[model samples]
Target: MEKSRGMLPRLFFFVSRPVRGTRGPARSTHVGAAGAFMSGGAGKRTAGPGRQGSRSALASVRAGAARVELERDDEMNCETRDSGVVAAGRAMTVLLDPGTGGAEANYPTRPITLVLGAAPGSGADILARALLPDIAAEVGQRLAIDYQPGASGNIGAARVARARPDGHTVLLSTRSASLHKVMYPYMDYDFARDLKPIAMVATMPIVVVMGNHVAANDMLDAMELARFNPGRYVCASVGVGTTNHVLCEILQASAGMRMQHIPYQSSAAALNDVVAGLVDFLFTPLSAALPHIKSRRVCAVAVTSQLRIDEIPDVPTIEEIGFSEAGADDWYALMAPTGTAPRIVARLNRALNAVLANRDVRQRLARLGYMAPG
Candidate 1:
């Protein structure tokens, strides 16, 4: 007889009544019963005719129970598979959906604050103000400037670090942001851990300017005078622990010279003293020193960059004068409080890059003695 699909021939055992002390040999009985039913397929079975009738009823009961269990297992597996697909779909949607994943999608729900770590008219402040209009338009929000100048920009940076990490408040910081932690080890907040760098806006070389009273004609002469006069001459910086102050120290050490360091509250004050002949010399930002240099109020001796600045090509770099180790440059960048959403940081970076890419903006920055980094 042909076997039925999804059926297996089950074997059953039976024995004749055992004789007195001896057991009769067991006889094998076979019955055709349906095997575990599988989806889209069936099993085969075979059996002898002699015992088929005897064990068919018993085999049918066991086979029926197994079939029910297999069917239940198949249903459970299908449900689990479907649930896995749904869960994966939900995760993909969350990752790809701008409303959910993109923090920049609806950012700056309120007016944004751009914090400058320097006084008004300082290099950082000027750069921040210059880029504000363009960044504001790109972000589609009204932007406000907040000046928190103190501790060589540490005060302003700490304020931003303590602010909520919601992208509403950001900082326009300079190299002082990194220098302050080392210069003032007792500070309350950590610079590296608290601030996140968004993008570098512009960089300008620090120029070494001397008051008109100084007899030095160039950097070589100035160093010679400082080496011999030592404490007789004085050097001014915008503030203690600032890039200017540090650069002056480096220059002194490299040249084996000594000069009095006068720290002013702002670059304007320092530059004012330099031009007025109160301070012998100052290491200041190009932006702050350009106007005075042009007016011949303060003589531009040398720049601290590797290359000469285009605005004042006549002024050679420190390296050109053989003081290669004294080269220093100042830079301004946008930063947010640590833990600000990455999407927001990316958005701000894009806006800054766009602003710096404009030809007119580049020209304006160039006139201020600032250059966009390559």
Candidate 2:
């Protein structure tokens, strides 16, 4: 495993947290505020907002190190923005304007770094790497993987936050990875505030499962219990700021119920405890839950996708029961530091999209429960 890259010189930017729902990628970053967490108050702070803007926001590992700062736009290297717009808390679907040449020609003159926020065996990590070679071909540069998985992807994200704006450094993250904003109040970084959404590689669904103890027949049955019991029950999340937690939040809001939360860094940990009757239920990736669901070790409660899944078509959707939450196929998008040249971002998006469109590549990703972007 790669040890931390130590402290990066701090480089801050004008972080913006767009409250709008995701349209098509690109939005501002957020610096979450501080919180006390489980013991008493809110959890960690968001990474951006509450953040003081400067080009150099680096936090050196050992401290007392001089920091590196970034300069405001030089005006000479400016590029146009994607046309996607934000409407009333929702993001608009937008596409990149294909670049003809210039940057594309010089792209990848050096080895490129692909920063993965999820763990090694995670679906997000799998999807990003599947497209890596194809992406490298497009840029004519050797691409590389710089895995920085930790603190619910925040550690890796923070690394990206301080990377050179030159676009050589790219972060691999997903919607589930992006849920840290509202879930934790003490996060030090925000997806919308620190990174630029380059392209959405693929999206998978989030599923809800019950522990051995639930004893409920279906979602409605459990709903009745949760409604009656309120805070008596609990839900499990992979981490503090994960879609698992967000799904729980959405469920609570819609069902008019409250289920306390228990957080773990990985699904394996949460699933093990949940199965052992240590924790309660969890809303996690289908990729991780399939094994348990097949063995009947855990109960499949609801799916968060818009439609049914081929693997488990009959599973009820959160919507069928009269609510919609963050259950859309969870997606992983490639992001570069904000201020990364628009040219480079477009080049990477195009190359990666090309890979997603490949037949063989599609099949490989399918096995991982990843569906390429249209």
Candidate 3:
């Protein structure tokens, strides 16, 4: 596997939040102002005019960090952005404590913990593992990976949101982290209100795959077979309301067909079931399914990206197959607790971009079927 290298270009930064009715990958919006100054009173200061200095300090720190990230981005020539994946220019949110102005010089006083919302061998996990050694070298500390997978990423996200707002602890999350609010409304933490976006990671397309035993040659054939036997085929997803599950729903809605939906706790488990023929087909991330597809354990029916992936050249895209609504990509990101100091956020962002700039890292991510900006 070490010899396997991707032929795709490089990936940069694009941090974005999900919006209603938006198509393609999510877009980045500046949340610096909202996070820069503490929000208690609306446009009014309750603690007299002394708070003005703190606000000003926050602004200065944010500006400095943004400049650093910009310089690093320019050094890497990070102009090429992939539409299928989220990329960003300025990836840090500004939130600073007036007293911690010089503390960033000594950031990551201890080992850092990168929390993953999915199980091992998942796309996000693969990304984190690939980047950890370089990131640890940049931050001058050992990086530890803590997996807290469950509840469609809500479990791990909530844990990160509640962690101390220090650089030592951060979350490496995916699109599912953004969707938990709507899927599990009764959750403990509010993702948008609690966590801060640090930097954009890699993005890969979702794929429609089937076991070898299935009688379908391609996506169109699979859909036709399902149409002939409605509700006879089973579709699998990591969990209900996950990006993959949503893709399953979209495929069915756009194709005007039905398949039994099976939800699992992890992408590996769901995909394993698909390979074992327990489940008929599945909508999964390319990172998880790539090895299986290469091994011929399962057949890729279609991809949910706007373009075809080099890893699987023969597989048709959902758009070409007339299921445009089902075409979408998944992204990974670095995030921290909301109150983390702006300088720390900026430091991490710089480290993340630096890692992405590495040729080996980019190639490894590409092998996972992630698209590079053209």
Candidate 4:
């Protein structure tokens, strides 16, 4: 129920587009000559030929309102009135005027791209899709959900980080996004530097489930089994450096046990292997592992939340098993590239708060074992 506070300004690259063939009063200014300045507008005409004859030329320069547009064809591009600016043979540009006002006034001139860092049907993906309708309705803009799954969500996150900070492209990510820096030191982008946290969406407890082949009935039993026969048991996680993987590591450290770590690319694959007894146990989202537990395909050991969840009240928590420090919750949040405009971030935070405040949205999220932010 905690809310995000304050607003942080993001970086923006301004591109000046002059009206073609429209001449106005001449204005002189001293600045760097880099890109092609088209004819027209209120600016002093530089000594350059018209657009038809020259391959590259500097047009009149003026300090006017800044506009940003998204280029869908390429991953991302930064356009500035500096060196090496190419105006010819470029994609269509949709101008975003930041000086207009708040996000409600001048944002989302186009469809917003909601990037999911996980595979389809995964917990993160499901949550992102579920919240789309309500968010789109509140924002008056359709959200285009894009899936970029790989490297435990780093690939998708990287794309968002490199995207234009026009609030059109944002990412819906989990805690795993923050853990990537420590896990993968050679990564191209830094999560904290490239991605800005907008607002928290929901939080859920991770359930510990064991296959039928395991004799452990509870977390205590699982710890004992691992202690007695070290390395005989293996735990499966959605991927390396994920929340579930970290939870397993916490459990191992807290319980003084050793087990082989098995990482899978997707939750479905990890769950399937766990059900087949190929992997002894798994710590996964309740929504993904609940059906298996109910069908008797996997034994519920314990949840990683500090308190028992309503969806599976019978499943004890890690704190209840005398390992309070091992408790961890899986959380999802809205994020944009660090350079996104402040008004856009504020607008997104407001819209998300409105959607989360909806009674029906809360009920739907609760049914999926997710706790909506207050």
TM-score of each: 0.72, 0.67, 0.73, 0.71
lDDT of 2 by residue, 1-374 (tens): 11111211121111112222221123321221111111111113332221232112222211332122211111101223453222213442334544433455576668888887766656566566667777777677888888776666787777887888788888876554444444444777665666776766666767888987886988878877766664566677666556555556545543555566665667777788778876667878877776788788888888766666666767887767665433344556677787777677777766675676688887776665555554
Q: What global local distance difference test value does model 2 have? A: 0.58
On lDDT, who's better, 1 or 2?
A: 1
Q: Give all candidates' CA lDDT scores.
A: 0.64, 0.58, 0.64, 0.64
Q: Candidate 4's error at 201, in angstroms?
A: 0.6
Best by TM-score: 3
For candidate 1, write residues 61-84 as lDDT tens digits: 434332211000112111111111
All-Cα superposition RMSD per candidate: 35.7, 14.0, 15.7, 22.4
lDDT of 2 at 288: 77
Stretches of model 1 off by over 4 angstroms after superposition: 1-103
Tens-digit lDDT track of model 3 for 1-374: 12112221121111122212211122312112111211111222132222344345334544543111111122121222211111223332222233433337678889999998889887778778878999899778999999998777888899998999987889987766665554565888877678876666766788888988789888778877866665567777776556677667545544545566766777789778777778888888898889999999999989877688888989988777765545667766678887887778767766777777788778877887774221
**How far does residue 172 in candidate 3 sit from its true spot (Å)?**
1.0
lDDT of 1 at 101: 34
| CA deviation > 4 Å runs, candidate 2 | 1-94, 99-103, 133-143, 176-194, 325-329
Model 4 lDDT on a 0 to 1 scale: 0.64
| lDDT minimum window of 10 residues, candidate 4 | 74-83
Model 3 alpha-carbon drift over 4 Å, by segment? 1-103, 372-374
